[model samples]
Target: MSHRTVNFKGNPVPLEGPELKPGDTAPNFRLQQNAADGLGDATLDDFAGKTLLISVVPSLDTSVCAQQTRTFNQKAAQLPDNVAVLTVSMDLPFAQARFCGTEHIDRIKVLSDHRTADFGRAYGLLIAEGPLQRILARAVFVVGPDRKIKYVEYVPEITQEPNYDAALAAVA
Candidate 1:
């Protein structure tokens, strides 16, 4: 574990992995997507060869997280089919599905890391302590078609939103 730190509000907290940067290979992950019958599996390989905008949030219930997901949903809907948008969080698949239905989040895929914090640990966004322990840090990653990171933004404060323009531009 890299155990890097990032500020949450005014407090500093440890994270579980290295702070990723552009040109790095995007880490592989196994996450869950909601299905009508039950939770379905999703993996990094499922998105192979597509440009991806991964919006990471601590939870969708928070205001900033909701707004961040909604912002990306709208932005991504206008993008080409080869570009895909995903929002990963600690929320369960059922909760994520409920949020998507309530928020009209059809343009993007809202995934769950609650089963296992694989995405968080892999991306270095897993909060390691304090009130938010086990939750993912607020961040954004743009993975190019080659599965290399094209952009990375770790929001300095967990309550804040990421740079929408910069991430969207990375996809363009």
Candidate 2:
């Protein structure tokens, strides 16, 4: 009984584990972004002391990906200032910034992992052995102000969406 990797566009990518859960300390890693605005870097500590919603997406160009980001951006408007909603993806920063502008998604931050795949590997979202190798799964994690995972949802099917309500409730 071995866990299989995820595939994207017919490529293989490996997942570190079956799933992540509440009370887990999100593995620490850095995210790299090469946005036209300039390069940006962030680690777990950058989001500490805030309710963190890490929305992991495979890519930002797809409808589901767009929906997932917009869904949280809409929700972020309702949450307190102390809560931070971050959408993580392998998409280039330029594309993310473009999408944000087009969608008017200002409430949340879109972080990229173009320079390094540490984010995917650390979070166990990297799909091993697929056309989308090294891409992250459609996973969501809610981390409390203390940096402990308050909730988590890793979509079993890469093509599916994460549980938005569950992620929001985790913060609530």
Candidate 3:
């Protein structure tokens, strides 16, 4: 059970798992990737030695989510190569691939959480109730090369965007 709550269009929605904070070691999670060999599992170990910026969203089909992904994709190029930005959502691998293709989102890797929801449960962003149940709330996390969480932001409102400046500054 999670004590933290987020608003989805003014209604409070419960979330599961412990809310992560700076200095906490990031939990290793296995998320699915769209691949020719079927779905492949990508873990935090896959991005070893890099500063990871995780952008969590509910779905790519929604306008705000799409914009969030695009914004991160655009900002990714400006950051150092050691910084890897990943957008995680509950959408299927195929859907995530199509969205990336259509949106020209190549810089940032968009991963699917539909398979195990490990990323959501580990990050404590999994919405536990309401129409958006099972979806991840909008959030941002920056994990340093040593695997310690440098920053975490769980947006109070589901419909709004995260504080990109602060999140990016944490990486610097």
Worst 10 residues of 2 by lDDT: 1-10
lDDT, candidate 1, 1-172, per-residue tens:
3457788887888899888999999999999999888889888899988999999999999999999999999888789999999999999898999999999999998889987787888899998777888999999999998999999999988888999999999998
Ranking by lDDT: 3, 1, 2
The residue-level lDDT of candidate 1 at 6 comes to: 80
- Ten-residue segment with the worst summed lDDT in candidate 1? 1-10
Off by over 4 Å in 3: none
- Tell how far residue 42 is off in model 2, in angstroms: 1.3
TM-score of every model? Answer: 0.96, 0.88, 0.96
**lDDT by residue for model 3 (59-96), tens:** 99999999999999999999999999999999999999
Assess candidate 3 and give its TM-score to the true structure: 0.96
lDDT of 3: 0.92
Candidate closest to the true structure, highest lDDT:
3
Q: Please give the lDDT score at residue 45 for candidate 2.
A: 87
